[model samples]
Target: MDEKEVPSLAEIHIAASHLRSMSLPITPILTSSILNTLTGRNIYLKCENFQRTGSFKSRGALNAVLNAMKIDPNLKGFVTHSSGNHGQALSYAASIVKRPCVVVVPRGTPKNKTDAIEHYGAELVICEPTPASRTSTCLQISQERDFLIIPPFDHPDVIAGQGTIAVELLEQVPDLDAILVPVSGGGLISGIALYAKRINPNIRIFACTPEGKMLEECLNKQERLWPEPPQFLNTKCEACRLQQCGSLTFPIMCSLVEKQVFTVSDKTMIDATRFAFERLKLVVELAAGLSLGAIISQSDRLDSNIRNIALILCGGNIDLNEKLPWQQ
Candidate 1:
């Protein structure tokens, strides 16, 4: 679909209504005392980590599959590439509808996420850890089979499905002044911004990204960080390390996100991971900490006038048993 055809808040509500008919509803938000203490504001956390399949990806995945099946009842399967969470989510969603799913994953995906993918019965196809390799393999598979592509991000249905978060959060917290969301392919933030703006045009949106890519600069230049993803895009956090934002999502972000973009280092994420665990009592993955890290580290950078904010705790699929470099 053309970027001009980006889904709106109305499409998101339609998606949410359909999802509920399938008995999939909403995820809840919770208070973050530690974050409030650190940021000195009433920061509410929209915990997608607690979402079914352990991430917000499930919403998009499910919506994509159901919509695909509605269009083509004879659809054999769905395909996509992911470092982890999206793969598992697609697999789980496909399982519920009793359709086959094939996920193209890079060689170094976290075991926790990979295990969840297989556990949901998706066929796992391993490729070299790069966008080219993953897409090539996925395309090759799609051509060989009749499987449709339910991309990790960038699709209208997927974006609309993700927007459901804003639908819930807006209702859950009536007076939220801002929302900080982690950005990779930019689907989550795009969806949320679409809904948030339509519901309350005054709500400020911000993007939080991993440091090295300089995503804000790339977005400004209309360029991507890594055409072929770098190796460091490995374990410390896989979710937000992608080279570029989605074509559909980037435009929405440039228009809607009012707050200055914030970036965080791996160390910041790891320390925040530890903080979330020790203080907040939430075992968040490193990437999940980017939202919290943005609020904690960039307190001065944010507009001082804004009072209440919400942070999207994107996911919690980290390998708890795997020895982190910090442990070593």
Candidate 2:
């Protein structure tokens, strides 16, 4: 779809209504004293981590699959490239709809993640985790078996589905002034920013990225950093280490996002994960901590009057018991 054809507020609402009509729960919960102490604001956590399939990706994946079925009743299946969360989401969604799913993942993808995808009955196709390799493999597979492409973050339907989070958050916390979200291909933040800002122009959207990925630096400098062989992209975060933002998402974020913050280290992420585990009693992955650490680190920039700040707790699809680099 052309960038001009991106979903507007009206279209987003239609997509959100589709999700609500299907009886999918969009869980938005108020933060506890731990979050308040950490962020120095009355933080509200939109626990997409507790969403269907245990991540926010289910919203977009389910919406895309259902919409595809509408377009083609015989829509054979769906395909995408994801290390973990999105793959599991698509696989689980397809299982519910009784549609086939084939996920193309990198060879380096963790076994636990691939197993989760397979557990939901999606066929796994492992390949190199580069734009060229992923696209080539997906196209080759699609040609052999008619599978619709459910890109992780590049499509309009996916963004519109993700925008539903903002819609729900607005209703749950009507007076929210800021929203913090972890950025990978920029899909979630783009959707949330568009819908939330359209409703309240005063709402500030912040993008949180892993420091190792350097996405925040790229966005802040307005230049692509890992713009070389594409294989240089940091895949450590597993889910989000793409070299560039989604073509559909970046442009929307250029105007919508208030700031982009890069995390310091994996150690910080581990610490935040443990903190969430002990304090919030939530199982957040390292990627999710990228957002929390951003807020904790940048407390000075936050506006004092910003009482209700929403954090999109995007996912909890990682093996927390595994030894992190920090543990060593």
Candidate 3:
């Protein structure tokens, strides 16, 4: 696939078929009475938390790996860098195909997440807690080992795989007025927006991110910002901690996503996370909480016409031993 190519609806459908044939369960869309009451709207939660490897990352990783193996029957292995969820997903995907995999993670990633990656049968490599360090380490390993580098969120196949979520979601909730998605490197939202917009031209796509300027500033300035400052890296929402959007994903987001990406505070995200566990009986991580937090803290900013909304609960990988954010 060309670097500039975006995934088409056909590609997304193909990905859905591939996943189904692999016996991956279709995650459910649930509704919370409390959330609906609070938001004064019909709120549907696309619960990817229950997905294989505990996140939607599984969809992209498996699709990318399958496509790579098809292209190169003699593929040696796979390599990539991730904070946590993607690493675990890729590891699980690689194992399914009986291929070796290596995951490079930052130094301070939670022990539970790192353990999960290894549990999925990937060799785990530690690197400095920076985007540059992670990328360099992954490239070095890929070069030395001749492993196919399956990036977390940049490639067309991965984006198409992620777009499968939109296909399932629209089928489940055909009349959805808007969707709130957590944005990290833009893969998830980019994929969703592409398919959702094509299916329902009037459907709105809102991006939810931790309180940071990386994405917001980039969108406002209409350009990519390199080397995000160190402070932005110190976020509680580790899933959304990427310094910038993916090169392929940013343009798609710019064209298809809502102009104003909703920013939620860390505290609001924590409250949302707690609410998910205590009230909704869902164990969502901080990144998933960002979308919920947007509804809780920024509902007033939403269009009055957006009565039926969907929130993508991106992941559920958290350290159970760690204290709740409220406790901290």
**Decoy 1 TM-score against native:** 0.92
Better of 2 and 3 by TM-score: 3
Q: Candidate 2 overall Cα lDDT vs. reference?
A: 0.79
The per-model lDDT (C-alpha) reads: 0.82, 0.79, 0.88
- Number of backbone collisions per candidate, in order? 0, 0, 0
Q: After superposition, how far is residue 196 of candidate 2 from its true place, in Å?
A: 0.4
- Candidate 2 residue-wise lDDT, 1-328, digit = tens: 2446577888788878888877789686857886788777887878887888778898888878878888899888888877778889899888978989999998887788888899999999989856788889988888889888898888888888898899899999878888988888888888898899889999988887766666666666665665655533343565566556876887777767864564546566667766767778888777777776666667667778877888777888767557743465
Q: Which run of 10 residues does model 1 get worst, by summed lDDT?
A: 226-235
The C-alpha stretches of model 1 lying farther than 4 A from their native spots are 1-4, 108-110, 218-235, 324-326
**How many clashing residue pairs, candidate 3?**
0
Which number leads on lDDT? 3
**Top model by TM-score, which number?**
3
TM-score of each: 0.92, 0.91, 0.95
lDDT of the structure predicted as candidate 1: 0.82
Q: Which regions of candidate 2 deviate over 4 angstroms?
A: 1-3, 128-131, 212-226, 231-236, 260-262, 324-328
Tens digits of per-residue lDDT for model 1, 29-134: 8886667878888898888888878888998899888888888899999899886788988998899889988999889876776888999999999999766898
